[model samples]
Target: MPFTQAFINESFRFKTLLPLNLMRSSVENSSILGNFIPKNTRVLANIWAVHNDPKVWLNPQIFNPNRFLTDDGKEVIKIDALIPFSTGKEILKTIPLVKQFK
Candidate 1:
């Protein structure tokens, strides 16, 4: 069922349920990728952008479940960029349930 799992993963990435993750406010002055951020600034993770980024995914517009499979097609490779749900410790807990129900 590797392809089945891969299909589910690719489906999650192809059309994310929520494009932007829940906003998080900065607690203190900081910077990201050379961009300065002041305290209390609201930040959102664009799950849609990560899933469709050409730099990380080849022909992202095409929904290819095979992209999530290993060369031997025996396992589903987890892509670091595939964060359809908000990322955190809690997200790790939800993945298995999502797959089970799907």
Candidate 2:
């Protein structure tokens, strides 16, 4: 059943397919969290680190598929931290292919 899909999602989160997202070059000079990013600088988001951050997820290292389920266990909760495909402009590009597998 689809219930097992939650486990799949959790598995992906536990061990991300791509530990680091694709490198993106900054189009313009920018400052993020007080850190300066000059134009053309290559930046990559650590997908594994974000998935394992305690601040964003409780017991992140533990395998807990229940975290993605609703209180009544009827639906999957939309969590902002569960971004294995990345949350940038390329996010939507992966949806169609991902949904086909499900």
Top lDDT: which candidate number?
1
Q: What is the lDDT for 16 in model 1?
A: 91
Name the 10 consecutive residues with the lowest summed lDDT in model 2.
92-101
TM-score of each: 0.80, 0.77
Q: Model 2 scores what on Cα lDDT? A: 0.71
lDDT tens per residue, model 1, 37-92: 79998766667877787868899999999999999999889877788677663443
Clash number by candidate, in order: 0, 0
Predicted candidate 1: what Cα RMSD to the true structure? 8.1
lDDT of 2 by residue, 1-102 (tens): 335877878988899888887887878887654567699997777778778878677899899988888877788876666776765855424432223222
Task: Please list the residue runs of candidate 1 whose C-alpha ends up more than 4 Å from where it truly belongs after superposition.
Answer: 89-102
As for candidate 1, its clashing pairs are none
